[model samples]
Target: MSIQTSRRALLAAAALAAPAIWGRDAVAQIRRGDELTVGIWGGAQERITRQFCATPLERQHGVKINYVLGGTPERRARAYAERGRPSFDLLYLNIFESRQAVKDGVTMASSANVPNFANLYDIAKIGGYAVAFNPVTIVYDRRKVAAPMTSWRDFWRDDLKGKVIWPTYPGAQGTSALLMAAKVWGGSESNIDPAFTNIARLRPFAAIQGSQDQLYGMFDQDVGAASVEFGSFTRKYAETRNPNIVIADPTEGQAIATNVACITTGTRNQALAEAFVNLHLSPECQAAYAEEIYYSPTIKNVSFAPELAAKLILGEAAVNKLVDFNWDLVIANQPRWSSRFTREIAG
Candidate 1:
């Protein structure tokens, strides 16, 4: 069956099974007087927390959740500098930063107590780290082009010169865009020079800096024909009367980005924090959050809403085709890469 079909089947099964799934475990773990603090990015992250995490966690566990909002890199640095006296107990960070944070000792090793750690998809539990969310496929404005655009190579087409708006240098997604360029030009984990050369070739077309909101605005105003942006952000944009916009999974393979959750070393509430992670990975929680926020579900058994399922790039087969990277290398090499990128492209 197609991914869409399987997703629908899964969602149907989850909806039918949710009440039974939450029956005893949730109540046993959470108490009425207990509270937990979670750190996440503002805007959409906050929205997801309110709509998905907070309400359900409160209802199921009788646990009150307090949210602290900031960019992951900044918040994580502060947490580590404070040396276990972090204001928030749980943190939500993008994959590369999450890996870096763990390496830096900002995050603690995950506890087995988180109920569904074993139930997570293999990729979600990289080593002992748990991915909290998945970004959707890249998107474009269909009205700006006629032919079907299929891969990252399409962005560099000579005919579409000076028409692409890209994220700023050093940004993870921006860097991913560069990696996509490398992949298209035959660069792999062992080689990246050709990709850098290819990017330099497209320097004339690049928009070096812009906020997500600004990128969306450029698309709406026809300032740019396309951009590589998160699926959820594009979907939200499409909902705001930009019916001409559409998402396309590149023929080569879809790229998937993750946000992760980990344990902290000095937590006084280790058990509670672990429980929260467990709840986050539960099928009920995954389905609820996926349906509400339009992100792909990470828990294997949880199902995405039909619309979201259709939009997600990392379906079963697609997941296998995803390119894996050494995030530590990427983080370490970021400065050098950014410098070269600025000198050649942004300068």
Candidate 2:
């Protein structure tokens, strides 16, 4: 092994007080009846997590998992407000929120804490250990959008005029969409002027939705042909509610981010928290998440069933077609971005 890998292995060995299982450290701190809380988005996500992740952890490690279910925004609010005393041990927060969590001294730093971190894709490690990919893309009602939408710029096509919607700012999908817009339209995170200018022009002809449900509702009514949302989210809504709705792989690529997992800084159960974090990156957990939820896995070379693999954003071909943004920039200038979207785009 290389020097770095040996050192990481030693670090993991020193931390675990018991034998390893499944090629991962199983520390004594994760004893029977000991509990670990995991915050996740409610509804379908929580369902899949319980069946695939929580049950197995409980069965194997004798650790009880208490899932704290809420909307992403609500859970993030709790994470920030609680900080040193977060209600959960492991929270599934967006990359931006996770990055902010680490900056605010809320995350346990280093791959040493979550040893499986070393097994993840490089992009997934950027803002803590990303557990799942959330590719923000152009979602449309296939029946209404006869031609495949080519790009975010397609929202402005003459045929789509007054028949398009824009995600409202201060929302993750919207913020990402606008940022993607800025970059593609000769503006950038540092210079969002052209983006706002063009957005203002499109405003009069576009509908604006503040939440995913509202966006889905607008699509149901044929109020718009396309809008921005995470690929997995689009799939979820399509399978359960709107069969005609589908994700459009834009020629310019989809804007990608992730739902990251981390052990909070002040956890009373640090070792168990770290263990659970490792399980999240485990091939088992990663595969379930990919297959069940359709969110891309972060671990390198995870094996998904053939049908499941078809639903995933896997392989180099799809990975190369994803657009990534600077989370630091997104987190830092959020206020200005929100204000611009409200004043210039939503007006």
Candidate 3:
């Protein structure tokens, strides 16, 4: 083997060995019925996590998973508030939030703790252990629009004037959509003036596609096109909810929004938390998440049937093609962007 490959092998071996060496002691900590709290989202996320990560860890370790299920904001707040004495052993955040958490020292370096970090795609390792990625792209009603939309520019078509619904301001989808708008125009992330200007021009939106339910329900109204929505939702909605819905592969590229898993700083059950994260990133859990929710796996080894693969954003090549936001800029300018969006676009 090459020197680098040999070194990587040694590191992986050591990572695997560390848990095993201390697991006997860790098992005692857990087998005493200690609760390892996991702050996660509700709905499909909660269901899949329970089935794949929590139940398996609980069964194997004889510990209970105290699930704190809610939105990311609440979970993030808890992580920040309880920094030195964190209640959440494992906290789930979006890529942006995860970065901020790491910077603020609210979260531990996931690579140091998560052994499966070695097996994931390099892109997925950016913020933390990004378990799944939901591509943000354009979704349109096939029946309402005469032609299939191919680019982000289609969102601004005269025909789609009153039919297109923008995601609410400060939301991930909306933030991503703004970046896309700026890019396709003559601007970039640092120069976001064009995005706001163009968004204002596309006035009298049909409705705000805020939540997942709202995104699905908007199609029944005058909504012919979504400025930006999750591709997984669009694909699933097309199959299960609305046959007329179609996801547009924009020429500019799709934004990658991810569900990142992080170990909170000062986690009491560090070993168990690492073990849970390891299992969460395991092939079985990753596959289940991809198959169940249509979110693409972050790990490189997980595979899907051809039919299912067609619906997902798979492989390293495809992952590289995704439009990555300047999250540092996005997060920093959020307040100003939100104010501008409210006064210009939403007003």
Clashes of each: 1, 0, 0
Model 2 lDDT per residue over 1-347, tens place: 11122334433332342222434445535667788888888876776556545665677667788988787777777777888987778787787777777888777554755667777777777656888887888898777664778788877777776777888887778877888788779988788787787777675644888888899888878888888888887797899999998788888888887888767778776667766677566665565566556888877756655766777788667776778777778778989878777777776
TM-score of each: 0.83, 0.85, 0.90
Provide the lDDT at 41 for model 3.
84
| Best prediction by TM-score | 3
Q: Model 1 Cα displacement at 344 (Å)?
A: 0.9
The per-model lDDT (C-alpha) reads 0.65, 0.73, 0.78
Candidate 1 Cα misplacement greater than 4 A, ranges? 1-34, 47-52, 55-64, 127-133, 304-308, 313-315
* Top-lDDT structure, candidate number: 3
**Deviating ranges (above 4 Å) for candidate 3:** 1-32
Ranking by lDDT: 3, 2, 1
Q: State the lDDT at 166 in candidate 3.
A: 89
lDDT tens digits, residue span 26-127, model 3: 443444466788889888888866766676666655778888889999999888999879989888999889988888889876674467788888878865
